[model samples]
Target: LKFVCFNNDGIDEHMVWLIGLKNIFARQLPNMPKEYIVRLVMDRTHKSVMIVRHNHVVGGITYRPYLSQKFGEIAFCAITADEQVKGYGTRLMNHLKQHARDVDGLTHFLTYADNNAVGYFIKQGFTKEIYLDKDRWQGYIKDYDGGILMECKMDPKLPYTD
Candidate 1:
């Protein structure tokens, strides 16, 4: 079991993992549009950190880095229904946090979580109190009705993956 970060660079290994992640998201997130998930997963500007266990993609987090703005906006995050409550979600998120901070030098992470996912995000250290500047993320993030926007500030001192 490992975490793979794909930036749509067309690498053969990452592409395979991306396909698995797309399928998982489509299956796990019944309320999200499949077409939307596919588009973002394949988009070059966006990136995904996939959890591949036993060579199968059990989960992933899709995000866009705004390094200059110091935050990476999380577009989609999900784990397979069968994999839920098994700690894969936390590890996937921790890996993403490590990538956002170590690889991209991002200082914060943000996401719009639906009601069902608020609890999960909260457990992952995200808060509804967005300390981010409005101008930095105002037009950058898309609004979804009934979704609550949350933010998580990265602590440079912590090894998030640990």
Candidate 2:
């Protein structure tokens, strides 16, 4: 597997891969509307990193940095259903974390993790927190279910960075 930044060359294949994973995505992210998820992936404003196998996107992550706030928010991440449990997710996340740290100088990382993903985030050294930042999340907080905010400090000692 190879990791690549999202670019015009691979966006179409990535979109197709995401569509194929829609069912799994719905199960993992029940609170997020499908349209919103697609929008996040297609939006050029956000940065994305993709894992490709045989020239097809099999896993990836999307994130946005709030540099002034010293934090980066992970918008979405997933591995193709067939690709799960092979450590690809961990590899992708580590890449994202390093990108955030080295490129953005972000000291913290935050993400709204689905219930099924909470444990994974915890294992990555994130701590759970009730996300009540209405100003930033707005109605999303109310719409979200079984999802909670998880955060990690970008310390070298953390498992996520190692």
Candidate 3:
């Protein structure tokens, strides 16, 4: 698998990648232009973005700054349908966690994902925080069976790398 990394600067390409991610993240189209997202991804203070591969575009992640300032939330992460369960998802998670820790100096990471992904995050060292009803979800809740929140402390002692 190819691990491609890019930010919002590449508007068209990023939007195309986001479209493919819709299903996995259960997010609705915002109607905002790609430039808006590019701005967020380009923001030096509050956010970051990473695309998994240039060709496959198998997965990508968006992280937003958290209350702690040094930490961030895994706002959105997705692996294409066909690429699921082939280790791309796990690799993507590892990459983002490392990025948040090593590159950004963030110690905590969080996510709210469908049940299908809860175990995956758990396996990656995240601990479940709570389970939220489908109604509480803001986007694409109807598309998923259920939702769960998880968090983990990013420490160098962990085997994962940036």
Question: Candidate 1 or 3, higher TM-score?
Answer: 1
lDDT of each: 0.90, 0.68, 0.58
Q: Ten residues in a row with the worst lDDT in model 3?
A: 136-145
Off by over 4 Å in 1: none
Query: Candidate 1, TM-score vs. the true structure?
Result: 0.96
Clashes of each: 0, 0, 1
lDDT of 1 at 135: 93
TM-scores for candidates 1 onward, in order? 0.96, 0.74, 0.63
Compared with the true structure, model 2 gives a TM-score of 0.74
Ranking by lDDT: 1, 2, 3
lDDT of 2 at 68: 63
Residue pairs in collision within model 2: none
State residue 122's C-alpha deviation in candidate 3, in Å: 0.9
* Candidate 2 minimal-lDDT segment of 10 residues: 134-143
* lDDT per residue (tens digit) for residues 1-162 in model 2: 677654223566656654544444555566778888767666655677777777676777777677666676788777777778888888888887777777777777778788788888887778886343435444332244566878777775444444
Q: Which candidate comes out best when scored by lDDT?
A: 1
Please name the candidate that would achieve the greatest TM-score relative to the true structure: 1
- Candidate 1, 34: how far from true, in Å? 1.1
